[model samples]
Target: MAYSKLCITLLTVVIFMLAANPDVAVANEATDELQRQIDSLVRRIEELEKRAGQSLNVPPAMAATGAASAGNGALQIGLSGLFAGGGSSVDNDALSRLQGGAHDPNQNGFVVQNVELSIGATVDPYFDAKAHLIFQIDSDGETVVELEEAFFTTRSLPGGLQIKGGQYFTEFGRQNKRHPHSWSFVDQPVVLSRFFGGDGLRGQGARLSWLTPTDWYSELIVGLQNAKGETMTSFLNAPGEEIGGHTLLDRDARRFGDLLYTARWLNGFDLSDTISMNLGVSGLWGPNASGDNTDTRIVGTDWYMKWLPARTQRGFPFVSWHTEVLWRQYEAGDLGIADRETLRDWGMFTQALWGFKPGWVAGLRWEYATADGDTATDPLRDTRKRLSPNLTWYPTEYSKLRLQYSRDWTEHLVDGSADTLWLQVEFGIGSHAAHVF
Candidate 1:
């Protein structure tokens, strides 16, 4: 095993060395650094394995969830980081995770930044909990302190109700609920990116959810949050905040009731022990958006289905079809508009996920939107459409790497029309944070 390990390390070093220089002796600086880290991790794991065989010298790493395993559950700990920089036709949310990458000419370029460290425990009775410290890299190259998520839960909630608190996701959209690093592209869809902005926020409040008790698995969630709104540099120079650059209004600012609801169901038909067709519906609703106040509301929904067919003796092949719609309505959007009353927008997204290999999935997405009644500057007053092809590779249970390309075209605009071609690559890592809902 050690010999094989040596070979892997040596191989990576060789590749990087070759890329460095054509005449220089093979000296892989970057690869060497990475290999050393991986080798150290492997050595530690090997030592732990050997000790377990003879006598327990050290405790096993617990799973991030801290839930005792049906299969010798062990405590698991992990570390992760990412850097992304990319250019684009417009500054959207799709490339939210990647740090440095090429982009379009007309679009704005942003540095992808996030530093996360987390720890968790897996306890007996199928329960687990985790705590995370999230560091956000702002556009102005400033570091911000925020609590990402901290929660625990059982693998299977009997009554389908999973209760969670502390800072975590707000259940706005499937993508919103998940970390940005897990996305295929560096940016999110236009609607989501435009509507939600970034990080969104973890309402330091509470969340409740219920799952189906049937063979058809389904889950529903209701969350009440404590927010002043999104967090960022202040936007207003009013009496309260300091000199503001970018102000995030939707932190936990639910005057009437900052609430969110989400529901999803899966209908799986067994086609042999390992093959099946899984179908379902998912949706989310809440008061969200940059300008929306207590009386305003933003809601979203998704309808989807998937087919998993036995393609190879040792490989699984599957494809999914899904659509999502998001809408935002503001009660009074007039900072200074005439008879300013309501501003509403909703967009639709449909995509398919096809498993090309055991750990590789490739798919495409089509998004469209129609905005009704907006300030004279509403670019989407007519309608919008775009298509994106995304590919993803999950190397382990805890990490994923993705790339995507998209073309956006629109007729209506606040001023001139804009067309864009965008590309993105992203890597996601983190098995240490799990806030169950």
Candidate 2:
């Protein structure tokens, strides 16, 4: 009789809990403790039923739960790397030296593209933190280590707002905010390399984001960052140097107004139960390295769309597409008595990926860039276009292999074109976070 009463009481409590919290059984990384307690109670109840010559059944929803981290602390460490080899026309080895290329070195032959290590943890109920370190080979053929990102983000803030501080990638465009390993292509687009620097726009900064109250997903973001560094291609206020007996930009002669400022508006919405799309607009402005206080401005638009079946087992027959267009204006000040010029340039790229089967994906991309002002002397600003097709196979969530082929065309340059074939291998270990959608 006592066991019967206990069982009845437990059932009543379970019903009440479910009624009060319908999501109590929702799977999450931090709910392992709750799941354990539930399992113990179910086991005891089953033992009681067996003794009473009765069988007890548990619902699958109550029996299955996600596993949490086994570590004592909240800290997590993850590592990812890419090694690539191929041949490029026009001897890209020389270009890679000048640009400090991101992702693949864009060089001939084999090279270790880069190795990245990430550490992250929740600081408390209100904050979380992350740090990323990158190791790569520099122009001098020396291995160099750099702190790519280290920032603290707010976990809870009023009015659907959040704040981030410290060094990080600025949300200037869709691709700038992504890590190299997450890129669809072997190298960054020509426009990104020419305007934002080969490494993608990033620096010490503070960012504030707000999720607007609406039926669809919408966000507004703004950031202020130090306008100095190799990544600061548009506003690289470097140290003073004598060029033809004239002083180049002097770092000491800088002002607060020279800081890089960025703003972006992003909107996302579902087209159907199985499809979604996102649209974004971004702008960046800052003073240029020309000590004369010349400035640079860039504006861009981005779009992304994805379609996947709702009840697919392995998420096959999926399609992902994205594109971005950028326009930039640069003022370099007077380099010569006869030259005081403002240059305009533009670039755009579109890509699509199709997952025809589980663990395999095929994609194609096209990119174009041109300088409206002049491309005669500046190879970086020259008119260029490329078409690339790639195939990727994933053995598991943590490892991937890819093969890509590209045909690059440069108008007005020696040889005017090149061909490249790239083989890339990537693997990740330890708690890795999902990439941004």
Pick by lDDT: which candidate is best?
2
Relative to the true structure, how large is the alpha-carbon lDDT of every model? Answer: 0.48, 0.71
List TM-score per model, in order.
Answer: 0.63, 0.79
Candidate 1: how large is its RMSD?
8.8
Q: Residue by residue across 75-185, what tens digits does model 1's lDDT show?
A: 443334333322444445422322111111122332324445555667666667766555554544445655677877656566767777666766655566655555445
232-325 per-residue lDDT for model 2 (tens digits)? 7767635562211224475532667778889999999999999999999999988776546677899999999999988664678899999999
lDDT of 2: 0.71
Cα RMSD for candidates in order: 8.8, 15.5
Question: What's the C-alpha lDDT at position 326 in model 1?
Answer: 75
